[model samples]
Target: MSMKLLAGSLIAAALTLAWGSPGLAGPARPLLLAQASQSAEDIFWQSVQNSTDPAMFQAYLDQVANGTFKGVYKPLAEIKLRALGKTAAPATPAPETTAQDRTTPPPATEPATPPPTQTAQDAASSPDIEACDRAAAHAMDDQKPANLPGVTFDKLDTSAAITACLRATKLADAPSREFFQLGRSYDKAGNYKEAMVAYKAAMEKGHKRAIYNVATGLMKTQRGVKKDPAAALALMERAVDEKVMFALSGLGDYYRLGVGGRRNYPKAIDYYNQAIAAGDSQGYVGLAIMTYDGTGIPRNRNKACDLWQKGSSLGDSNAADYSKRYCRYR
Candidate 1:
C-alpha cells in the first residue's frame, strides 16, 4: 500500500487504542522526554503501546465507545484487540432495576447510573475517568526485546512484548523503537518511502540504530534516501559512537573499502577491534578478511582461518561460510 494510505490507516487506528500499539525501553525512552507538545490523543496512543492489562485495554475502549469520539474511535478498539491477539471480553448487560412503579417514581428513560454499571457512552464522557486512567496508561513499556529469529515470527506476548517486537521483528511502532521497526518492516515490504519516513521519525528521536538502519544497514543501498557512501558512512559512525554493536562492523567496512573517503586500513582494523570487544562476531570476519588479503595486517592464512572459526562459533553467518572455504582449503 502507499505510504499515505498506510500512515492514514495507522493514524486512524492509533486514535482508538487504549494501551498502545503492540512494543519498550525504559531508561532510554526518548519519545516521552523529547516531544513536548503531545496531545491527549498522543498520550493515549502511547499508553496503548505499552499497556498489558486486558482490563485496562477494555476500559479505554469502553471510554472511546461511549465517549465523544465513538464514531471514529469505537472501531479502533476492535483493531487494537485484534492486534493484541485477543478478543474483547463480552460486556455484561445492565440489569433491570427492581424498584416498583408504585413505590418509587418511574426512572427516566435514561436515568443517572452508578459507577459499576455505567454504559460505554457514560464512561466515554467521563473526562475524569480518562484522566484517572492516565496513571496506569501513560507508562512506557519497560520490557526488553525478545529473541526472535531474523527470518520468522515468534509467539509474542502482547502486553510485555511491544518493545520486543519493535526491536526484533522490526514491523511495529509506538515511538523510537517502534518507528525504527516500522521503517524496517516497510523496507522489507517494498515500501521504501514509508520506511524512510519512519526512519526519519526515529532519527529525530536520537535513535542511533535508526541512523544506521535508514542508511540501509550501513550499505548505502536503500531507496527513498539519496544514497551516498559518505552519508551512509557518517550514519554508521553515529551509530558506532553510540556503541551499537553491529555498527562497528559497518564502520570497519567504510574504512576498509574507502566507501565514503580514502581507505584507511588502520582505522578499519581499529574499528574491527572495537567491534570484537563489543562482542559482535562480524568484527572478527572483517578483521580476518583483511588478514587474508594482507591489508593492514601481514598475510597469515592460518590466523585468518582461526579468526573465521572463532567468529563462526560466535554466530557470524559470513564467518561460518568463510571458515568452510578458507579453513577447508588452506
Candidate 2:
C-alpha cells in the first residue's frame, strides 16, 4: 500500500511538472491551441491591413465566411472601433427592447429643411469663384513671356506665352497695348503662327507698328499666305517710298537678284545709284561691280575704280580686293 501511494504521488508530480514548468518536455495542448488561435487572428488582421480596395476586403470577408479563419472573425465595424482604441462589444445583434422602454424618439418621416437662400452680392462674392479668378490672374502674370536683350527671335519659347497672352487678352479684356506687346513677345519667342495672329488682332485695333510688324513678318516667313515675292517687293517699295534707306538698298538687291519678277538691270542700277546717293558704302560697291563688269551700264573702268576706292575706304571687302587687284595705279 505504501509503495502504491508513493507511485501515485510521483505520477501527480510528473504531470504537474510537464504541464506547468518552463523546463517541461512539450507545450500543453490548451497553450498550443491558444497560440494557433492568436496566429490566425494575426493573419486576419494582416489581410485587413494590407487590403487596398473594397474588392480585396470583400474577398477577405468571404474567406472568414467560409471558415478559413481558424479564430473568430470580428465584424469590420468592431475592428475599426478597436483600431480607434475604443472598447468594442461583439457584433451579435442585441435583442430589440420594448418600444415603451426606448428612450430616444423615432426618426421623423418628413423631408429635411432647405438651406438658406444667398443674396446676389453673396453669390457674386463666392469664395470658390473668387479663388479661381485669383488663381487665373496669378497664372497669367506668372506665365507671361518676358523679353531678354541679346536673345535671338529664333531661340525663344513662345507656346506657353502665346497661350497665356491669348487667355489674358480674351478673358481679362486687356488693352491694345497688351495685344501688341503679346504679338511682339510671340515674335521674339519664335512662334510665327501666334505672332501673325496677335499682330492681326493688334492691327484691327489700329496699331500702326503692329501693321508694319505683320507685313515684315509675313515677308520674312511667308506665314499662312503664299510666298508672294511681289507682295514682299511692294511692301519694301512702300518702305522705300517712305524714305527708308535700308529699304532702298534691299530693293536694289531684290531687283539685281531678280527675286520678285523679271530681272530689270536698269532698274537695279537706278536703285543702286539711289542707295549710293543716300551714302551707303555697300550700295557703292554694288554699283562699282555693275560698272566694272558692264552688267547694268556701259563699262567705265575710271568710274568703277573711283567707286571701288570709295567703297574700299568705307570697309567693303570686295571693293577693297578690287581696288587692290584692278584699280591700283602701277
Candidate 3:
C-alpha cells in the first residue's frame, strides 16, 4: 500500500483507541495520538526514501513511541497494534526472586583503618631519621675547606663536587664534615672563591684547620672580599695563636717575602724561629737564605753557611745544596 494510505489507517486506529466507543465520551481525548501519528509518518517516509537500515528504522520507530510519543499517545500496546506490521501481544515480566533464593551474598567488606600518627618524640627517636640529622650536623660542623682532613683531589670535577658539598653544608645551622669536604673540593677544583667561603664558614664554627685555610686561600688568591694584606696578616696571626705548625711556616714565608703590607726581616726571623721551634726544617732554609742574601740583616756569609749546614741536617734540600757548594768547613 502507498505510505499515505498506510498512515491514514494508522491514524484512524489511534483515534478509535483514544476515544474509546466515540458514542459516550465525556470530553474527546487530547489529539495526542493524531499528532504522534503525523510525526511517526514523517519519520517513516524520510527513512524509507533515504534507504535507512531496516533494523535502525524499526528501532527509531520504537524509540519515538516510547519517548517523544509517550504520555501523548495510548501505551505501546495500542500503538504497536496500529503500526504497519503483523500483530503480536506484549510479553509478561518474570516473577521476582526471594532473598533466601538469591544466588550469592555480596562480597564481605573490611572496615577502613586510619593511618597511625607519629608523636614528635617518636619521630626524633626514629633510627633512620636520627641518622639523617646526625649526618647533617656533621656536614655543618665540617663545612670549611682548611679544616678538612685527608683531602686528596683526583681531578677538577672532584673540586666541583667539593664545592657542591660545601654549598649543601652551608645550609645547615652548624659546620659538618660535608662542609670540610666541600672546601677541599673547591680548593682542588682551583675554584678559590667557593673554597675561601667554605674555609671561613669552618673557621667561624671553631675549626682550626679552616682558620689556617682561610688565611692561605686569601693570601694565594687575593680574593673573597677585599684583598687586604692587613686582614691576611691578622688571619695568619690568629692561626699562629692556634699553634698550627704550617701556619707558622706560612707566616714566616709571608714576612720573608714582604707580603701582607710590610717588609720586616727581624719579624721574618722571629717567625722562622717559631717555625723551627715547631720542628719545621723549611724554616731553617728561609733563615739561611736571609743571612746569605744580607737582606735586612748584616752581611754574614760564614753565618749563612753555618745555618745551611744546620738546615741540611734537618732534611732541608735547599740547605743541602747550599752547604754542598759553600759549607766545606761543615
Give RMSD to native, each candidate: 16.0, 28.9, 34.4
Q: Which ten residues in a row have the lowest lDDT in candidate 2?
A: 135-144
- TM-score of each candidate? 0.50, 0.35, 0.45
State residue 26's C-alpha deviation in candidate 2, in Å.
Answer: 80
TM-score (C-alpha) between model 1 and the true structure: 0.50
Top-lDDT candidate index? 1
lDDT of 3 by residue, 187-294 (tens): 664546556766677677677767767776666444333455667778988989987656777788788886787777888889888888888776777887888788
Stretches off by above 4 angstroms in model 1 are 1-173
- The C-alpha lDDT values of all candidates are 0.60, 0.55, 0.57
Candidate 2 lDDT: 0.55
**Count of backbone collisions in candidate 2:** 0
Q: Measured by C-alpha RMSD in angstroms, how accurate is candidate 3?
A: 34.4
lDDT of 2 by residue, 107-191 (tens): 7789879986655445334543232222222111222223212223344344434434444454333444346555765566544
True-structure lDDT of candidate 1: 0.60
* Top TM-score hit: 1
Better of 1 and 2 by lDDT: 1
| Candidate 2 runs further than 4 Å off | 1-226, 288-294, 298-330
Instruction: Report the C-alpha displacement of residue 79, candidate 2, in angstroms.
Output: 54
